[model samples]
Target: MTCTIFYTTAMPNDRAQVSGTAPRKPMRWAVEYLIKTPDGRTLVESTKTIQRATFEELRAIMDHIIGAIGDEAGNIASFVSWRATARGGRSKRRARR
Candidate 1:
C-alpha cells in the first residue's frame, strides 16, 4: 500500500460567524489523505478539516487508514514528518530515526 498526506492552514472563520455567548473558533488545519494499493487501486481519498484535532481523533484516523491498507508485503506502516520553517522551507536538520 502507498499513502500520501498533504496539509494546509485554514482560514479564520472561513465558514461563518455565528452569534453566541461561547467563544467562536474556526478550523485551523486541513489534511488531505490518499491511500492506494500496490496495484494502483485507490482505497481511501479524503480531506479532514478540524478546529483542533485531539490525539484520539488523529489516532482514529491513522487506525482507519492502516486498517484499510491491511498488513501486506510492500506496504508502508511507518511514517515520519518534518516541520516546516517560518520561511516555508523544511527544517535545516533532517528527521532522525
Candidate 2:
C-alpha cells in the first residue's frame, strides 16, 4: 500500500484527507506538513493528494514554507529540519556472535 502527504497553509480544521472520506476529526487544529527528499529536494509524490480539492482555492503553499523551515533550522529550533541528509549513511558491518 502507498500513502501521500497533504500540505496546507490554513490551520487544518482537522487532518481529515477529505471531509466526506476518511475518519473524521475530533477537534480542528492548525497543522501543516512538509516532506523533503534526502537530496534536499521536495518529493514529487505530492501531486497525488489533489483528488477532491478545487484547483483555484487549494494551493500547494509549500515553496515558501520550505524556505521558512530552512531558515528556522539556521536559527536552531526543535522540529526544524536543517538538512535532510544531516545524518549520513553508516558504515556497513557484519553481525558477530
Candidate 3:
C-alpha cells in the first residue's frame, strides 16, 4: 500500500494539536496526510474524519506531488518527509529483512 500526502490549510482545531507536539519552537507544516487506523475507519492522528482513501490513490499523489517537491528545503528538516537515499540509508535490517 502507498500513501499520498498533501498540504492543506491549517484548520482552527489543527492549530492546538500541532502546537502541542513541537512546543517551544516555531512550527510550520505545508500539508496534512490522513491515514486509516487498523479498525477500518479514518483517523487524523487520533481525530477521526469522514474522509476515506485508498493506498494506491495516496501513492499517486505522493509520486506526482511530494516525491518531487522538496530537496533544498526552505522550510523544514530532511527527515520530516521520506527521502530516497542516494546510496541507501546504510542499513543493517535492510540487508536482513
CA lDDT of each prediction against the hidden true structure: 0.36, 0.32, 0.29
**By the TM-score metric, which is better: model 1 or model 3?**
1
Best by TM-score: 1
| Candidate with the greatest lDDT versus the true structure | 1
C-alpha positional error of residue 25 in candidate 3 after TM-score superposition, expressed in Å:
40
Q: Which lDDT tens digits does candidate 1 get at residues 12-93?
A: 5322222212212221234444455446655443344434533224435545545555564256533312111111213358
State TM-scores per candidate: 0.29, 0.22, 0.22
lDDT of 3: 0.29
Q: Write the per-residue lDDT of candidate 3 for residues 19-80, one digit (tens) a residue.
A: 11121222122234443323444423322221232322333444454333333233232222
The TM-score between candidate 1 and the true structure equals: 0.29
Could you give the C-alpha RMSD of every candidate to the true structure, in order shown?
17.1, 17.1, 16.9
